[model samples]
Target: MAIKTKNISPDGKRQMTMQQFTAWLGRFDADKDGKISRQELADAVRGAGGRFAWWKCRQGLRSADSDGSGYIDANEIGNLVEFAQKHLGVKIVGF
Candidate 1:
């Protein structure tokens, strides 16, 4: 089925903007290495009050890390947010 952005959040409370996604990505860069690892992504999501399985989070990071560097940057995070918004139907707003 075709996915739509509007289908991301049903309550319209978790819609996250590009800026917010970028900010979250920055915060997730725990080591400040300009990239976020699988663990870092999980920690970042958890820290933001979002619950996700560690393995799942890791898998997501791995899938989104297009450069094969084992890390995800702002662009990757943005894509991830868009994917989550489309699939999870959670309006991920600014934290």
Candidate 2:
């Protein structure tokens, strides 16, 4: 995630619409290539102060990149919902 637009709940989980969640993820597209690369994802998580960002990104990329393209694309963003909610503390409330 981009470490921006944090909407925390009382229980400490971040709440956001799917739009906000995807936007946050999109903020890390450093090359403006319309897809999130492994390096970009790792950098973003590390920038967010997440522990073991490399490892986490590895897993996230593995899980989210359903097509094995080694990047998260627009069509595959929803595949990241589960990983984001678990590791990124995001709750995508709705589309």
Candidate 3:
């Protein structure tokens, strides 16, 4: 059987899959607590060739966090991608 995938880009272009996003989030969880802290998110953003100021990173983390938790999870990472896509007009394919 052939498997189907969903595209997240605005132009219907194929982008990173959910599994890939989750894997990337796993890599970002430096402390391996199944959650990503603001510092970890900032480091990951910087490492991914994106410039992030301390305050901006903190705000991003707060915005991406949906559950009101202090940390972000894999799902939150997906939301972060969408947020960046909307605000920055950049397509984040993966980590």
Candidate 4:
């Protein structure tokens, strides 16, 4: 089951569109495996000017890896998206 993420803005409107999330995934799915690995996520975070903490990455994987796959797949993508938004506080535009 996909975890639900509340993307509503202050006015309770959708803040991010699906296309934006898909584009975000494409930025980190370097192998095109439909999943974001720890290294890929770390690289993406670092590339975004965020501190790359190995421990935090592991924690993130644990938080987002709903299926115990050690990677963030489509089902858990919401968690990763929320993590980046909360932690990095950057508007991730297309690459």
TM-score of each: 0.65, 0.87, 0.63, 0.67
Query: Which ranges in model 1 have alpha carbons more than 4 Å from their true place?
Result: 1-12, 86-95
lDDT of each: 0.61, 0.82, 0.62, 0.64
Best by lDDT: 2
| Per-residue lDDT of candidate 1, residues 1-95 (tens digit) | 11123435556545556665566557657688887788876775565455564865676676688777777875576557654554344455663
Tens-digit lDDT string for candidate 2 (37-94): 9998887677666778889899999999999999999999998889877887667787
Candidates arranged by TM-score, highest first: 2, 4, 1, 3
Candidate 4 lDDT, 4-77, residue by residue in tens:
23565554333455557556556778899888899877766665556655765776787789899888888787
Error of 4 at 5 (Å): 21
Better of 2 and 4 by TM-score: 2
Question: Which one wins by lDDT: 1 or 4?
Answer: 4
Clashing pairs in 1: 8-89, 14-91, 14-92, 14-93, 15-91, 15-92
lDDT of 3 by residue, 1-95 (tens): 11123654677443665565556546767789988888876766564445554665677777889998868876676667775454332455645
Off by over 4 Å in 2: none
For residue 85, model 4's alpha carbon misses the true position, in angstroms, by: 1.9
- In model 4, the runs with Cα more than 4 Å from the true position are 1-18, 91-95
